[model samples]
Target: MKSPIFSRSSSPLNSHSSISPPLTPRRTFPETIMEENIDYATTIITKWDLDGPTYRKMSSLFGDDRKEAKRFIEGVTGLRNAMHYYLKINSSSEKLIRAQRLMQVAMKRLEKEFYYILSSNRNVLDAESVSRGSTRSSLSDSLEDEVQGDEIIEDGNSISEADKASLMAMADLKSIADCMIGSGYGKECVRIYDLIRKSIIDESLYNLGVEKINPSQIQKMDWNVLEAKIKSWLQAVKIAVKNLFYGERILCDSVFSSSEKIAESCFAEISRDAAINLFGFPENFAKSKKILSPEKMFRALDLYEAISDLWPDIEMIFSYDSLSAVKCQGVASLVKLGESIRVMLTQFELAIQKDSSKSPSTGGVHPLTRYVMNYLVFLGDYSGVMSDTVADWPLNAQTPLPESYFSSPISGGSAIEDPSSAVTVRLAWLILVLLCKLDGKASLYNDVALSYLFLANNLNYVVSKVQNSNLGLLMGSEWISKHESKVKQYTGNYERMGWIKVIMSLPKNPTAEFSLQEVKEIFSLFNSGFEGTYKKQSGWVIPDRKLREEIKLSLAKKIVPSYRVFYEKHRGKIGREFGVESIVRYAPEDLNNYLSDLFFGTEVSTSTKTWSSYETSSESSLSSHRR
Candidate 1:
């Protein structure tokens, strides 16, 4: 057979002359050996040439001719080998020119097929579906095997239809990508892939309701609107990090598994900008001045927590050096949120200390007590997040809490005992500030007994609040017990100061023999003192039902029994001398009836109306803070 390597005369190197040049002796292969090699290369390329009429009529190489797709890749490989062989032996050979032309035609076909597969499989290749497909390790192994000319085999019974479709499409993409990239057409392939995939990610974020919010826009928004956005962002961020960006990364890594440089470049170009914007929203929102109020502290903590919880995923997905800005943005949001919460906490403590409102006239719960306790209770619910935010934040050093302040075994040991208990100590400190303020407010009362009653009422409220909610868990049982004891002590003082005169009026022994004049003096003094005590305490109040009953029971044990014994013993003697109705004004049953009416808070004297106005004003103030 004529040697095909030297048989062609249509070569550009031969077209300029009709005669061949004089032969120079050189090492050469036998005609049969060179002819067989050239013939084999031409056969492979001719068999799968995509420029043939049949392939031209077809829509896509991968779609219309699935079997030929494998042959087509093999043909490109064969063409590449033939061109290299010809370049080494005869650089201007007609066979090399034909092989170069075929390579270009093959590249054009693969690029079109790559775009077709991507555009047609958008649904199957969505973020959720792709993430649900093969894991990165397995996918990379399969891609490496495919590059080495091994068919990737997956169990059809294992994955769902969507997952199977995604894997199959991904395999097809990587196959074409490997061939095209090997042939130096990577830029064309990457451009198409980047444009289509970037839009998908951007659309996914939009569907998730993540928007690019600026600080100025957040500042101008109504709190209600901003709160809604924060809520939306919270939900969107989880899906973005775990599914959207995660799946894109897996897909990119698998498709470009053959080239680490190209894979990192493509993944960063497609995902970095969107990820930065998604995380930057929280930072911008935290930077807004309007959300700095104490009332908005919870929302800021929620933002901090979402980023904190997703930190591992963020670190893993955006680990590339080019994606560092996304990680930086996420960290900045957390810092801004933590700073906002700390500022609000300071504002909250100041609001308690600076409260100038008069104490309630009835000596019931103060408005500040209700507001601060309720605020702390809500805050305690977020202890997990708050602990992280305030871990490094120590309490103010200038004010200097006493060692005994947190000394109770239940008050979290000592204030500085557990360095990890920053939030616990911070909350405890706020309550302490409130208690000190209540002590100052107690001084507003002129009547010593009412002042004690006020302290008892406010302290009892604080104890009840601590016992009822998450505060109980954070402050521990011992803390609640210690505060309860303080409440009891205040109530004990109240009982002594409020009714000492009435109790002192009775004789040391009610049955002691005495003259009618002495007995008359006793009855007169008892009548005058009991009436005065009742009139003075008529408007005082204890709002807590349980505490009110407890105080009443204590008083009954101390006052009612003794008074009853004295009254029964003296009544007949006093009446025999002076008329019973005139001297013995109160029957024992009458004391019980009056004590039941004590804490109703129905009427206050004009002298104490300033204290009475506190209820309305403080309630109004608390309502405004809530809004």
Candidate 2:
């Protein structure tokens, strides 16, 4: 009932280029030398031919044992050298040309044969896509039909046998990929594994009888078949990783090394394959049209979380616990994983920024910023582990510790001061790093107000989380206070910058020169400021209710009294000269109401009103400010 997996190899055409001597001075190599070269090239071409059964014979002898697989893989070095020698050598002779074509054939054959052998050995549990009794040729034909816009066979039983053969071929390819990993070809093994998965997924979807799986077309898929393919693909990858670790001592050694490059490679491949499956095909793939779904994103996060939760198991698998091998208990691995996740979050943030920028109507916080900050919140749970691991870290000489951060009793006598402070300070610094990154994402907003508001909200959220969690201990109270100040700074900047023009319009200290002409100018200034600010800010939104209140109150404190005093002193006097009511365009009460409406984003009418509500609000604001 398993779905069939398929694979194909594109054979490169033979190309020729050779340098010739201008003068015919025939200095011929010895016959023995020429014969030896030809024999070596021929031997290489023969062994390299997967279709010739040479590799199959070797695999049968080597069996599935890791040690033997390594040995058999090593034996291919000579054949590889010969093939390279044939390809790189300068020759236009018929013999060389013929040999090159043979080499190409041998390569294609090996590719096909290896895949089939591996598939057969694995008993591919996902062969449901392939019809029973189909040949490779027929599978290729079916692929062509699908590509040519032919209808898909809806019946599960009608799945082509050629499809099954292709799947088997893919299995054989994975087996070879396993051998590659065992042979210390870590990067190459990863590449091969990625290619194999992409091929299977691409083929299955292509044969699924749909151009693209739109929302409406999603129901057309045979869920059982798709699920089987997904399960088999994931299981195969797991098995490959297990084989690589358990079978080859060299692989185990490399994977568990201090550098952990091999482990990183494996994880990268796993992440990529998982992402492709869950998130849909990358843009390069044909018929790739899946929207970024929430389910896929959450699943991706879950995969990362699962890995994070099982860090100890991963360490054990790679023998990271060997006392002499590594100095720390899984700290290095965890740090590396954290770094990788940060990179993913950065990419997500950029993507969100790009999409949001394209649509100007969208308002409020971006999901990318939320997702990354939420992830950091979860990551904060491990601050204790991180702090403990790096507790004895030497103080950074370049960046001296602040005096305020050393109030702990541990700072009493020794010049060295609190050791725990070093870890905690850096933990705080790391949290700041995420905030700074989120700030960068917020800057991508087209609306300046939205950008600042986004930053304020996120920065505020991060500070709260860190102070509330164990991360606070590492970062210390001083660190939390510093970031809290920064959030306030942002809010302050938003108020001051956005309303600078409006504030500037208020009259300064009245002097002897403040006559009827100056009074008219002051009224003019007030009218212009009210008109400009109301028009500019009316449509802008402040999603957080508390932030809105704080912003509005701050504005009222700055504008209410200045306007109330200016209007009371000058309103009647200026109105008489400029025709009474015309000169006093807006009353003191009108100024208070306008200030209250500042961040509420409500519309304002420019018509004149009486001063009944002015004294109470202005007195209250002035009293609060004095306190």
Candidate 3:
């Protein structure tokens, strides 16, 4: 067909040449020329008309013959261009009617092909494969080539059959979608895509165990049931963000590569509600009143951590302005989780502060000590995540802690800056609170010596727990070392207060000459003091084996040598007057043997021992001498 032309008026070469020429009113094409162009457009449109008898015999023009599919798309483009020309040339032309009918047929055909490719290649065009294929620039280039009549090959074995099929299906979908959207059939195209893909997204999430649980249902759930659900959510969220939503985005972008706005709109429409519901679960769980217990805090932190860890994926996938609510939901969940955890931590600290168990343990590890240390050890396992949760939360101590409390040698006062030190300092502070409560419990003991022993036992337990657990890493070696030294100091005080009287009862000058009367008095005093101290201490207990042995050795070293010297020096003179067995109740070897049985918590009966007989004999002999 001959193309139409437009003529423009020119200014004559005169004095007005420097001035701009008047604009020309272009003449319209003649009726004959418009008819010729419309006829030519009709021929191209009819030759590829998808509903024609010849094309119908070949089902799926895009699938059965890609080269023919390329021509059909190009023919539709030419027909659309010619229709625009005819409308401007003769808006009421009878010849333009046939081309418009052909246009409708071609669009319906392309729509059917688009639906067929998506339905038949469900596995090949799956979200994971499409997402994977979208990363390759070659996939885009290959689609362009297919639109221009290039056959895809799978010869090199570089790509799997599944990958090759995925590439071909994606290329077909992109080519057909571009044509339909470009021709203003975008709404129809987007509707079909959203229907099928939205179902896939919802089903994938369901299979991954994600559900649309409301806040009321979650609040009423038993913790055991809720915890199980939380565990399932932790597993599902990773797949939902990184795979399901991500894959849907890639498919949308690839198919609507020609229109970014349409691609974003389609993806947001298909995945927005599911994404919001998926992320909103944690926030709902966090807001539930029943989940605020200290024991449940870890699960809350777990949800916070999963969201925190997956945030980058969540942000990138929902980067579209239309999908901003999905991203906001994720962030809101994290905030809720963090708030819940902080409240529980506050409650836990209060429990420690108000612990009112007044009965003293028998020089063994107290029940409070065990409970607090065990709780802190588990809390330490989550230090990395907990640090982020509590980074801005300062310890709100009722009594301000002195700088020396954090700086104390055994406090392991290493000020770790941001993100970690908050939890470390917080845990350390809880332990300190427990120690203070224990000090009060120690006062319930009437024996000053046993009170010190109680302090030694409980402190040793605390230091040992920190040493053996993740607390060691969080609290640092300096803290462990300093507290260890404190345990030793307690044991030393107990030794002095507990056994000093026995050690002091011996004569200061053991080897000095003394008359028989003075020697008898000295021997009698030694026997009475040693028997009473040993009997009382045998009931006290130390639970740790290493500390038990160490304390025993220390007491023996201090008391044994001095007692041995005094007993030997006075035995000879006293035995000559009274008999060695009557005056000497214990040998040096007996002191070491008695110290071995000291901390077992069972009282050794002195009633059956030689010491009781000596006490009776000495008292009767003194009575007879006085008469």
Write model 1 residue lDDT over 60-127, tens digit each, in one string.
76665555667677667666766777788889989778777767877877887898898899989877
Off by over 4 Å in 1: 1-57, 87-91, 140-158, 406-419, 514-528, 574-579, 602-627
The TM-scores, one per candidate, come to 0.83, 0.37, 0.80
Worst 10 residues of 2 by lDDT: 279-288
TM-score of 1: 0.83
lDDT, model 1: 0.77
Q: Which candidate is the best by TM-score?
A: 1
Query: Which portions of model 3 show Cα errors greater than 4 Å?
Result: 1-59, 93-95, 141-157, 358-360, 407-417, 507-534, 563-590, 598-627
> For residues 1-627, could you state the per-residue lDDT of candidate 3 as single tens digits?
433332223324433546666997764566445456555646645665675656666777767777666667777776676667767766776555666776787788788888888888888877678876876654452344534333344442356668767888888888888888877788888888888888888888999999999889998898779888998998999888888888888888888899999999999999999999999999999999998876677788778878988988888989999999998899899888889999998888877677665533467776667666776777787787788888888776765767445422333334454467788778888888888888887887898888889899999988898999888887778777888888899999999999877877776777778888787777677677778888887778898999999999999988888778877776776665546676777889998998998898842222332323333343343222110
> Residue 124 lDDT in model 2?
39
Q: What is the lDDT of residue 304 in candidate 1?
A: 84
Q: lDDT tens string, model 2, 1-627?
A: 533332222212222343444796663564345445556646654654555666555544222333433333333433344334545565565655665565455444434444445335333324322222222223221122322222234233344545543343433344454434443344544554345534544454344421332334433445445334433433333332233222222222222233355544443443333223322311111121231322123222333343344444334444522231221322433344334333443444444333322111222333333344444444445443433334555434232545443222234534245555544554444444455556665676665655666567666766666667656655566667877788788778777766777788776653224677778877777678777877766666555677677877788888777877776676666554546666677776776676666544432212122111221243342222110
* Global lDDT scores for all candidate models: 0.77, 0.45, 0.77
Evaluate candidate 3 by giving its C-alpha RMSD to the native, one decimal.
13.6
